[model samples]
Target chain A: MSSLILTHTRYQMLEQMRIPISWVASAFFPAASMLAFVVPFAAADPVAATRATGSMMMIGAISAALIGLSITVSQDREQPWNHYLRTLPAGPLPRFAGRIFTSMAIMAVAVIPVLVIAALFTEAAITWPRLLLGIGALLAGSVPFMLIGLFLGFTLPSKAAIAVSQLLFFPMCILGGLFLPPQIMPDFVQALSPYVPSRGAVELVWSATTGSAADPAGLVMLAVWTVAAGVAAVWAYRRDEGRRFA
Target chain B: MAVLARSAEVTRRYGDVVALDRVSLDIRAGELVGLLGPNGAGKSTLINLFVGLRRPTSGTVELFGGSPRDPLIRRHVGVTPQETGLPEVLRVAEIVDFVSAHFPDRVATPELLDRFGLGDLAKRQVGGLSGGQRRRLAVALAFAGRPKMVFLDEPTTGLDVEARRTLWDGVRSFHEEGGTVLLTSHYLEEIEALAQRVVVVGHGRVLADDTVQAVRDVVGVRRVSLVAGTLPELPGVLGVEHADGRTHLVTTDPDRLVVELVRSGTPFSGLEIRPTTLEEAFLAITSQETTSKETTSEETTSKESTHV
Candidate 1:
């Protein structure tokens, strides 16, 4: 079983490598945001620069975990090859694990550009242990987004998945305060920021990297969203299975 | 021989449409059975049921004496669906390896590829393959697991003669090694080449299940064409059609049909009696089923032909 999982993961990763542009895009966006926003405005303030860096990393993780993963899943569902694999005696576990592992690897790779920019040009300072903690938090924060991706992928067709993931992505990024700090946003926007999954995700990163007190509401909502999305994702998978095979 | 797969009184309905109705079949070990049917005749549906891709609306489908829905039962079976898409970026060899990994025992990648005439294209990406090559790859993947039984649904649908011959060789070799096979095809010659027994399906029902020659004899229809204004009611006439002032009569026994026609005192000329090909035999059998359903309100049995 372990060998099957490993084989699936290796082949999936190899498939992704065949098209490097998507991976490059995930890393590029976060670094570009860092160079444009952080280098000029918050370079001198250590705490501000560190928080901004964390938010940028959140953008990268969301791209990989939410948008990229969803699109790939929906597309995979449309393929006859995927249906054939499901018919195999190994069951769905190996393929499911392989996809999740590959998505997490993408999430990790996406954060590198943000990390490099922070090290080179910003006053974003962190100890080695804190850096490790921040990485751990980043993965944890991505869980809700990954689940959301799975939900969209299983429920929607590929064309709708591409459109809806993007539609959900931009609004959530802005409303979640990834682009601007919630403190500086207008009253209405600030009130809504704590509820979005992205805000909760970035809050964990901020607390880990900058030693800031985390927002309790944000963490609690993150947990709520994770559970809800997990339920929805499982339901979507079962619905798809019923439609195709039952 | 032990039965490897069996479907008992299986009926599958899609809304009001009966895709498969009261179909029962048994595929024994070391037997190469061909499933011959027209489009929407439930050949694909039967294959889907055996592979556990779809469940029958009524009745039971078994593989290896267990439920086909069991993944363990599926472990001993390999399947190539009617239409398949391979991951475009993966090489031929990689795709084989990935599928092979799912089974406990598998054929070596190189040997499997070589058997399917894909040895030289091992490094080629699937997207780079031609339509025939891609089709061959899709068919070849079924054997990668070294399964005891293989289900191939139209395995050579879009292949050149050479490619089709190469695929036949691979399937023949597998059957020679005592591998059970059940394949569906629209091509009669394909069935004649590989299958020792043929099961004919029409209108979601089994019309004929016999050896290739026996199926031909089951229909045994002959075309008797002549130029005539009209013909009297003829004995053993299954179907009659008129075109360009010429009458064509289809019947099981042309000898009996012609004697009755002449006895009727119908003036006719340009008489032609041609032995029907397997394709014509198949068409006659399936078309007979349709006409029977349309003419009678009763549940139509396959062998009962309505005289027209």
Candidate 2:
């Protein structure tokens, strides 16, 4: 079973590598954002820079976990090869696991550019152990976004999936205070910030890297979103299977 | 012979439409059976049910003496759906390897490709191949698992003569080695060339299930053409059409129709008689069923064409 999963992941990765653009797309935004916002404004302040850098990392992770994954899943549904694979005796579990692993790999790759930009252009100083803890927090926080991606992918066609994920992403980032500190944001936006999954994710990273206090409400909402998204994703998958094959 | 796959009293309905109605079929071991039907005759639906891609609304579908829904039961089965799209970026060899890995016992990628006349194209990307090559590759993938039974739905639909012949050879060699096959096609020529047994479906029901020769005899509609003005009503005439100063009559017994034509004493010229194509013969059978008023209520409401 492990070998089968590895084979599936290898081929999926190979397919993604051949395209190349999606990888660039995931890495580009967060790195560019760091250069624009964090370098000029927050570079001199170590704690502020560290927090900003953490937010930038979440942006990179979301690009791969949410946008890229949803698009690939929706497009795969339109393929005859995918349909044939579902009919195989190995079933859908290996392919599903492979996709998740591939997305997470891309997510990891995406954060590298942001991390480099933080080290070079900004004073986002952190110990090696703290950076490792932050990275672990980043992956844990990405779970809800991945589940949300699967939900969108199964519920919509490729075109609609692309449109909807983009529609959801920018608001989640801005309102979650990834660009500016939530402390300075307007009162209404601050109130709404903790409700979004991204706020919980960025808060987890910030506390890990900058030694700040994490919001208990933010952590609670993150868990809430993960459970909700998990249920939604499973429902969507079964619905899709019934519609196509039944 | 042992039945490798069986569908007993299967009925599948989609919303208000009945895609298949009380359809029962048995694909025995070491036999090549062709399912000949018009568009929307439920040929594809039956194949889907047998392969466990879909379930019967009523009745049972079994593979290798077990439930088709079981993955282990399906391990000995192979299928190529009516339409499919391979990942455009993958090479032929890579795709073959990917599919082969899913089976416990598999043919080597190179050997499988060579068997289907794709040995030279193994290094080529699927996106670069022409339509014929893509089709051949699609059909070839069905045998990758070395399955005991294969279901091919319109396996050679868009291929040219040569390409179609190549695919037929691949299927024939498999059957010659005692593999069970059930393939669906709109072309009777395809069935005649490869299948020993032919099952004819029309309006979601099996119209005829017999040997190829027996089916031909049953649907023996011959066309008789002559220049006759205002011809008399002829016995055994299944259909009639007039064009270019000639009246063409399709009938089961051309000899009896000819004798009747002569006894009527109508002036005629340029007389000719010949066997009709399968399409025309199939139309005759369905029309005979219709005129005799044997159609169920659901059949009359069916939007599917009875003609090929």
Candidate 3:
């Protein structure tokens, strides 16, 4: 099973590399936003810059995780190659794992440009251990987003997946206070910010980078979103299987 | 011979639409059967059941004497759907290797490519291949696993004469090596060329299940042709198609029609009558069966539409 999954990952990654546009599309936006927004104003202050950098990284990861996976998964469903894969005796597990791993790889690639921009242009400071811890947390936080991507991909057509993932991504980013610090946000948004999964993700990154305490309520909500997304992803996948093949 | 696949009074429905109406079929090992039907005659639905892609609403489907849902059975079965889009990025050899990995045993990639006449295109990306090339690759992928039984659903729907012949050669070789095949196609020539037994399906039921020659014999319709400036509605004309300066009419009784034509002084010349070919047989069989079915169900105000 693992060998098949590894092969699937290798092939999927090769397919993505051949396309190139999908990775570039997800990678460009957050890095562009970082250069345009974070590097200009937030760079002078070390703590502020680090927080902003963490937020930007999550933004890039979210774009890759949500929009990228959703679009690719939906598009794959429209292909006959996917049908052939599904009918294999090994079932859909290897392909699904391959896709999830590929999404993670894309998210990792997307964050690199943001990290480079922050390291070069900003005063954001981080110890090696702190950076490692922060990277781990960010990877963990991306699971819910990946799950949401799967839900969207299996439930909707490719065109609708593109529109819907984008629509959902932006609202969550803004509401989670990724664009601006929660302290500077309006009272109502500040209150709602901690409940959003993106806030929980960014909070973990911020805490790891700056030695600040993570928000317990925010972490709990992130866990909740992860669970909810997990259920929805499974339901969507099974529904797709039933509707198309059964 | 052992039964390779069997559907025992299987019925399939999509909501209110009954796609397969208690259809029963048995495919024995070493048999190359042609599932000949017009669009929406339950050919695909039956294939889906045997493939374990869909479950029957009633009765049962078995593959290799076991349930079709068994992966053990599916592992030995291969299918090429009516339409498949091969991975655009993968080279032909890589696609063959990747899919072949699923089975315990498979044909080597190079040999598989050569057999399908895709040896030169083995290094070419699927996206760059022309329509016929991609088609060859798609059908080739089905054989890579070296399955015991193969299903080709209208495999040559859009291929030209040469491409279709190439595919037919590959199919014939597979059968010669003792592979069981259940092929569906609108092209009567394809059926005549490959299938020894022809199963004619209409209105979700089998109209005729017999040897290919027997099915052709059952059609009974004859073709009549003439070069008339204007052709009127005639008594026995079942279908009309015009080409060049002449109109072709298919009918059950050409002698009576010709007599009527002579008595009416229809000013027709260059008259000829010919035996019905497989195309006319299929059309007549399917249309006749469906028309009869329509009469039986005509009283129901709300009937399932066959548009799809």
* Tens-digit per-residue lDDT, A141-209, candidate 3: 888898899889989988999999999999889988889888888899989998889999988888888
True contacts kept of 1: 0.51
Identify the leading candidate in terms of lDDT. 1
**Per-model lDDT:** 0.83, 0.82, 0.81
Which stretches of candidate 2 lie above 4 Å from their native place? A174-177, A185-196, A211-217, A220-228, A242-246, B65-67, B81-84, B223-236, B239-249, B266-280, B287-308
Which of the CAPRI classes, incorrect, acceptable, medium or high, describes model 2? Answer: acceptable
Q: Per model, how many backbone clashes are there?
A: 0, 0, 0
DockQ, each predicted model: 0.33, 0.32, 0.22
**lDDT, ranked from best to worst:** 1, 2, 3
Residue pairs in collision within model 2: none
Looking at candidate 1 chain B, the ten consecutive residues that score lowest on lDDT are: B299-308
Ranked candidates (DockQ, high to low)? 1, 2, 3
TM-score of 1: 0.85
Q: Which digits, one per residue and each the tens of the lDDT, describe model 2 over residues B197-272?
A: 9888877889999887777678888889999789998999888999998999999999999899899998899999
Off by over 4 Å in 1: A35-37, A183-196, A216-228, A241-246, B15-17, B81-84, B223-250, B260-277, B292-308
Chain B TM-score, all predictions listed: 0.83, 0.85, 0.89
- Reference contacts preserved by each model: 0.51, 0.44, 0.29
